[model samples]
Target: MNPLTVLRDSLYFFQRNLSQIVTLCLPLVIVEAILQRIVDDAVGPDASAGFGLIVGLLVYPLYTAALILFLDARSRGESPRNRELLAQAVNLWPRFALLSAISTLLIVLGLSMFFIPGIFLTVVLAFSEYRLVLRGEAPLAAMKSSFNLSRGHFWRIFVCILAVLGPLMLLKEFSYSLFSKDDNTLLSLVLDSANSFLQLFVSVVLFRLFMLISDKSDQ
Candidate 1:
């Protein structure tokens, strides 16, 4: 799997389907951003990190799950109904939420050990959500399968992930620098929406990687 090609194709898909993507996921993204802002205001930064995780677990999975289903439908050349996709995602919410929570906890635990281990864990566990959503595995099983699936493809997956996420992270930092925490709420919402929208491309690239590696492994 060529990471660059995956990156290129993911971006192409993102651009080509920007309208559909936005139509399906943008509300959830904006809602998430708003909820996050509320949490920050309520608890301040010094509050337990778990509060942030809790909020993420509440909002992130809904949109991400929808996007994954949406991407799958598009790849198969089916014109998906946004409402139908959202309904399916809502139905799948509990399991996906569990997967998200597990993934976050593991990443946090790894980070607590050391920064490098956290990155390593992030790379290794990256495919867990795909396994859960795409393959219909239970949450824990999906995580285990992701560990197994990612075993030999660590660098490849890492490269794809970094390629997709690096620029998004940089944009996030730059956006934050442009506005203080107390900056105009509307501007912050717009930037946050943009960042969240672009972050979906990371899932697209990984979906490509998962398909590639899954095919290769099957052979």
Candidate 2:
């Protein structure tokens, strides 16, 4: 699994299906950002950061599951409507939410332990969402499976993630420097939504890698 090939293909897919993806996920992403902003405003600057995570948990699973299902459908050459995909995602919400929460907690915990472990955890747990959503595994089981699945392919996955996210992180910093959220709430919201939406491309690349690894593992 060459990281460049994975990135190139994922970029192509992202560009090709940009319209459908925006229709399917952008509203939810904007909603999440708006809710987060509301929470921030209510709690003031001293607000607990975890409040944002709580808001995310409420809506993240919905759109993320829908996006994943859409990715699967497109890969299989089936054209699924957004509403239908959303309904299926809603049905899968409970499991997906649980999985996401667990993953986030573990990643956060790892980050607290000097940061390197966090990066390691992120890489190894990359495919847990795919395992859970695509194969119906329980949250913990999916995480464990991802750990095993990512064994030899860790560098490829890690490099691919960094390649995609590195520039985005810089863009985020640059945006913040130009417009303080407190002073320009609307612009902040727009930037936040756009950044979050672009991050979905990481999911696309990871899905590609997941299929490749799964195929090899099965064979």
**Number of backbone clashes in candidate 2:** 0
TM-score for predicted model 1 compared with the true structure: 0.95
Task: For residues 159-205, write the lDDT of model 1, one tens digit per residue.
Answer: 88887688889978987997874768778778888888888888888
lDDT of 2 at 101: 86
Candidate 2 C-alpha error for residue 73, in Å: 0.5
What TM-score quantifies how close candidate 2 is to the native fold?
A: 0.98
Instruction: Give all candidate RMSDs, comma-separated.
Output: 1.3, 0.8
- Lowest-lDDT window of 10 residues in candidate 1? 180-189
lDDT of 2: 0.93
RMSD of 2: 0.8
* TM-scores of all candidate predictions against the true structure: 0.95, 0.98
Candidate 2 structure quality by residue, lDDT tens digits, 1-219: 778999999999999999999999999999999999888888987987688879988999999889999999999999999999999989888988898888898889999999999999999999998988889988899999999999999899999999989999999999899888778888989999999999999999999999999999999
lDDT (CA) per prediction: 0.86, 0.93
